[model samples]
Target: MFALYSGSLAEPGDPNPYAGGESLVLPKLWFAGYRRMLRVRIETGPAMQRYRAASRLN
Candidate 1:
């Protein structure tokens, strides 16, 4: 996972040099695959919950 930060200050006198001025460069295919993984997780979340509940009952 990657984190994006903007306008972040490191100290009272120090500030991020790239903050608000730079953008992250990532491959389009990588971003697309990440999004697909997220979609699968979201779609299966409810089913996983149901499976867990049934296992507890059994």
Candidate 2:
């Protein structure tokens, strides 16, 4: 669990990383979220369509 957050933990109650790390969050989460976002965008961003198509076939 600790390793999973490698760098996404929002400290105590904040969702934002430390001050110097603010910029890194977007790119980091981008790559993290981009995996699914990419699969979705491959068919069209917010790719639930692709996911749905696959699910229907299954």
Candidate 3:
């Protein structure tokens, strides 16, 4: 995890070493409600539609 944040895992010659990082520090106020926003997006997103369709077929 430390390696990822520090861009050590990125390819040696790549121009953007930290291109795909998925972790960061947010302000306390922003951090508090971020997950709820993500949860709502996931529940209503196209992936949820695909999941429901597959479950019905099963």
Q: Best-fitting candidate, measured by TM-score?
A: 3
List the global CA lDDT of all models: 0.47, 0.46, 0.48
Order of candidates by lDDT, top first? 3, 1, 2
For candidate 1, write residues 1-58 as lDDT tens digits: 2322221212223333444544544333334445555566766789888998999999
lDDT of 2 by residue, 1-58 (tens): 3322433333323332333454655545534443544444465645677788889998
Global CA lDDT computed for model 1: 0.47
Candidate 1, which ten residues in sequence have the lowest lDDT sum?
3-12
In model 2, the runs with Cα more than 4 Å from the true position are 1-22, 39-58
Give the CA lDDT, 0 to 100, for residue 13 in model 1.
38
lDDT tens digits, residue span 27-47, model 3 = 222333444445656788899
Residue pairs in clash, model 1: none
TM-score winner between 2 and 3, please give it. 3
Name the runs in model 1 displaced over 4 angstroms: 1-26, 47-58
